[model samples]
Each structure stands twice: as C-alpha cells, then as structure tokens.
Target chain A: MPRLDWEIYEMIERNPFFKHIGFELVNSSEEEILLKLSIKTDLLNTNKTLHGGVHASMLDTVQSIALRSLYQCPVTAMNLDVHYFAPANTGHLFARAKLLQKGYKMAVLEAEIIDENTTLIAKGTGTYKIVRNA
Target chain B: MKLPVTRSTFFEYLGFNSTKTDTFHLDLPLQAILLQDDGTVHPGVFSTMLDISMGATASLETNSFATTIHLNVSFFDLSPKENYHAKTNIVNIEGKVITAEGIVYGQDGAVAAKAIGMFKASPIKQ
Candidate 1:
C-alpha cells in the first residue's frame, strides 16, 4: 500500500478524460495552482455558446485534480457558487484555483475562469469534504 | 444562444401569475431521459437545468443585470417520466442581494425540487 499510495501521482497522469480535455499543469505556489485548457467545439452548449455544464464540470475537475496532488485523500465538492461576468465564447479557457482555507476535513477553493484575452468570464468558489473510502 | 428557440414562448405559455421568476424559463417535454447514466440525462442534469432556470429568472427580474451569486437547491424526488417542467418567481431583493424562490414540478405535476437563491447586483462606483 505504501508503494501504491506514492503512485497516485502517476495514476492521475494516466487518466484519459483529463488528457482528452487538455487539462495541463501549468504552475503552482503555496496551495494555489493554475490549469490551462483549450477551447473545443464539443464543449459548447445548446445555444452554440459554452455550456454551463462544461463550465461546472471543468471547474469541478480542476479543483479535484489540484486537491488530489496536495491531500492524502482526495475530496469531493459539496457546493459550488459561480458568477458569470461575460459569455465564454470560442477561445482558450484558463482556470486558476487556490486553496483559501483548509479545515480538518473541509477546504475552500476560490477560482476564476479567464479567456485568452485575460478577460474574467466567471468566478467561482466551492467547499470540499474529504472522506475515507478504503 | 445557449438556450433553445422556444425560450420566448415561456412568457405566453406558462400562465404567468407572479410576473417574475428567479430561475430560467424552460418548456416541457425536453429531449432528455429522466433516468440514465450513459451520457443520457443524469440526475444532476435536472438540478443543473433548474439552477440555470433560477439564474435566468434573476436576470429578468433585476432589470436584466442581476448575476448569480448564491444558489441554494434541494432535491426531493425524481421524475417518473421523461417530461421536464419548471416555473419560478422572484421572492425579494435586498440592497445587493436579490432572492428568488420557486418550485420545479415533475411531469406528473408533483414537486421534484425547491430552490431559493440570492443574486448579487453589480457594484456601482459613484
């Protein structure tokens, strides 16, 4: 188990969906991390614009991914609060998240969604709870 | 156009009695299955859609500028059929926070979910 626990980093690296969405590890400082993603056509919503689900999914995934790298056991989102400043059109989307505070088993994440132009399209925060599975 | 073409008909169709909604307006008989896991409509789909509806209703009530800041949702049950429907209204608005509460009825006209949200108005620099 000691060997496998140390191998989670490599296991996460092999996830196909994370690779397909082009989620990249850019930079990190303290508890904050930056993730870069490409704007793909299939990520759009029913209005031909960016789907809200995509935004939620991407934000949720990156938060969990970043947490996995730092925590002994990964956490899940309990609630999400998002604010959209403008429409996220076709272009590169960048999500940067930071750990605002971490409790014994809960943490708060503050993140922003920026486009290629560095425009802030959405701002979000979530509460995560860590639990034991095995 | 993140919404469907029938988005306009909601005003005349849903029999509006409150004149305001905190959620987005969506019509019934959606092209989604109520129960499925294989990329078919997941249970969260209804919640997401309902959240969107509530957020949209906030935009309409607050002079079309209110943005979603706090959304509280509670799920009570699931739809037995594939049909989807929702109706909402603005409950109140504080100085910076606007509150909207409404109910989402299942295809059988039973309550499936109830939600209350607070949308923060943009800060004005004066």
Candidate 2:
C-alpha cells in the first residue's frame, strides 16, 4: 500500500515474533501509525472468549512505538489506564495511535482498538517516562 | 442438588450470579489497545483482566485472603489491531508474593504480549 512506510514495515517484518503475532504496519507518518491483528482462538481465554489483558499489553506497545517513531530514546510505560466497552470478540482489529501530547520528561499517548465491525473493544491512555541516550 | 460451597470455590462460594446461559468468557490476546484514528482498546482493560487472572491463580494456593500490591507490565508491541486469543497460567506461588505470567496470542498463534505480574496474599485478617 502507498500509505505504508518502509521504516516501520521493515522493522516489524524483520522481527520473528512480530510476524507470528500477525501484525504489520499498515501506514505511518511522523508521529502516528496504524496496526492490524487477525482474530483467532489461540488468543482467546479459558472462558472460551477473548481476554482483556491482551488489549492492555497491545495499547502499551503501540503508544511506546508511536513515540519512538519520532524520538529515539528509551521511553518506559510509567502509568497506564484502560477502559473496555462491550466485547471485542471477532475479526480483525484496527488501531490508530497518535501523539496526544509530549512533555520534557514524559509523554501522553492515546489508543483505540476497534473490531472488524468497527465496534469499540477498549480505549486507554498512557504516560511514558523519557530516558537518556537521546 | 447439593451445596457447592467450598474453600476453593471463591467465584461460586461468593455466590456469583452468572446464569448458565452466560457462557462468554475471554482475555486479552494483546498488551493494550491501539489508539489510532480508527480506534483502539486500552491497556487498563488488560491490566484489570490480568489482575483478575492473577487474583484467581493466587487464591488457588493461598490460605484465606490476599490483596494485590503492585503490578508491572513490560509491553513490547501494540496488541494486534486484528483479533486474537489469550491464555494465563500461574507461574510461581511464593510466601507473600504470588507471581504469574499471561501470554496473548495473535492471529498466527504468536505471543502478542507477555506479562509478568505480582499479587500479595494473606490469611483472613483476624
């Protein structure tokens, strides 16, 4: 796709684990990016349903990556807040991550995970502490 | 037909009101939600789920009561924007701290996210 960026695409494409996770860079700009995942049973929980921990880990990852896209520094997730509405039970999910705001020592980012039906699965905000090696 | 109450049946001993029809149960196959323009899920949701699993796993080995002091999650990539599954199993059970690991799988059965967290348990306070 013309909208896809080579840098991130190459990074994800190269990672063995990333490839197994079934996520690839769909598109990217300077401080924003999109990720996609295919839904399946292995991701489900003992309840014979999808688990919430899955979403939490993901939002944290994208938010950090969204920041790394511009600034090359070690940013760690200091705090995370997530909210779930309904359930993300089927199909692929589409996520859009953008730089909500940035500070001198930390940054705030937001993410949304939507199912194939465009239903909202979960939403979250995170604060990443910027470290040295900048 | 009989009382199903027991020391281990917390969910049931507590008298959870889940109808038999409510068979839907699930966990996060990823770390957190994606916050792209299209939409995304939140990490807090996963944290909550992790807490639930951790609490349950801990209760199994614990004596009476327990509380979670702190939980730390090291997230690598965004949980897939697509769909996936999740599995959580207790990793270790210690004296005061209960440690557990939950792994989320993406479309390809790969680890979408790996989380190691801790929960504190104790006997019922007298």
Candidate 3:
C-alpha cells in the first residue's frame, strides 16, 4: 500500500451518512485507518445496543478507507461477513481496519469494532472491487 | 400471534417498512443517503435490511426476541432505481439459535442480494 496522508481521510469524512452517524477518523494511514463513533439512541437496536446494520456499515466504510488510501479509487463491496462478539450500547466505539490482500481486481480487508475499554465488540471481513479512476 | 414493527430509529432513517400478511416481508425506498458514489444501494444498507428482516422472521417464527450473532451477505446485482424489496424465512431453529435466509430484489425484479443470519433467541432484557 502506498503511503497516504490525511487529505484523503478528510475527503471521505465529509460523507453525510458518515457525519450523520457520527464517525470520527482517529487515525489514517496507508496500512490501516482508525475510526471512532459515538453511541447514540438513534444508532441503537431494539435491544439497546449498536445496531447490526450500523456496525456492518462502519466496517464497510472503514475497510474502504484503507483501500482507498492506497488505490485512490472508489470500491464496491462484493461480500461482507460480520461476527458480533458483544453488544456495543454505551461509551465510545472504535473501528480499526487493514487490508488483508489486494490483487488486480479485488481486495480483501478486515476490521474490528472495539469499545472504549478496547473490548472487541464485533469483527468484519469484506471483499471490495476497485473501480478505475474516472 | 403477530409482533409489532419493533420500533427502531435506524429503520426509520433508512425508510424501512415491514408487513404481516400470512408472511413477513420488508421494503425500503432507496434513499440517497444510503447510496454509494456509483449510485447503487450500499451493501451496508443491504446488510441492515437483512439483519432486520431475519430478526423479524426469527421473532415471528419462534415468538421471541432475537439478537444477531452473525450475518453474511452476497451481492448478485445492483439497483438502478429508488426502491428495493426483501423477504426472509427461518431456515432452522434449534432451542436458542435461529438461522434465517433472505433475498433482496431490485426494482427490476432481479435478485440483487442474498443473506444468511444467525440470531440468538431470548427474552427481552429490561
């Protein structure tokens, strides 16, 4: 992965949903990207924990951030597998993502969602297809 | 022997709608906020829909609340319009774990995605 600076991360943080969902980029590099999100009632499920969809969404976005910083291109998710280790209902949640592998057409990335105490809340692995820059 | 919509703000934000008429089904208007740069429905949105649908199916099938343990989705197509549909059914239920499968259909009636989710059936805490 090519070295990337902060500008690309800033550009992606401008997404409305990312903002609406309250995702903060804690750190960004070519190797990995770290994001933090506040737990809000709106982001909760019926059981009062961070909703499954939100976790999946954040994983998708964070994994893409890792790939985008390197490929400088938009990516689409082909497959996503998420495992919930525990419920995220309080405090802050952090998502850390890194590229597992990349090829000519597809890239595999992995991410983990952790609580403020660094407890693993959820884990995700996804395959993204890199599109050519327009 | 039916459950309510199981209110959730995230579902409302995504414009998710559920119905009960012999079978449970889900529908959502492809909102702009849920679209990727290429204008297709984001896979995360699909995941959320699948999660909700499967949860609803588990609730209806087992008549209890469920917490999602794991979910896996595969994308087969993409939508080019402003709407999508999802239908789910319980594939298996063994005591406390329920497994469900669902399909997402694009507006053009093509299979856009499919997902399988595992949920833990339990009583609502608090």
Tell me the lDDT of model 2 at A52.
49
- DockQ of every candidate: 0.10, 0.09, 0.65
Write the residue-wise lDDT of candidate 1 on A1-134 in tens digits. 01223344454465444554455766544445667767666554333455454455456556765665567575655656666666665777888777778777877777788889999877777667765462
TM-score of chain B of each: 0.63, 0.55, 0.90
- TM-scores of all models? 0.56, 0.52, 0.92
Writing each residue's lDDT as its tens digit, candidate 1 over B1-126 gives: 243322322122222122223235564454322222222333334445554566567655564444455454454554244565767787887786778775767677877666666666653222
Residue-level error in angstroms, candidate 3, position B38: 3.7
- Which candidate number maximizes TM-score? 3
| Tens-digit lDDT string for candidate 3 (B1-126) | 544466678887778887776778788887677765556666788899889988887877877888899999987765456678899988899989999999988788888889999999888766
| Deviation from truth (RMSD, Å), model 1 | 8.3
Kindly list the per-residue Cα lDDT of model 3 for residues A53-99, writing each as its tens digit: 99998898788778878788777788999999898787898898877
Cα displacement (angstroms), candidate 1, residue B53, comes to 3.4
Candidate 2 docking quality: incorrect, acceptable, medium or high? incorrect
lDDT of 2 by residue, A64-84 (tens): 667756565546666665555
Ten-residue segment with the worst summed lDDT in candidate 2 chain A?
A: A1-10
**Which candidate gets the maximum lDDT versus the true structure?**
3
Angstrom error of the Cα, residue B61, model 2: value is: 12
- The CAPRI-style docking tier of model 3 reads medium
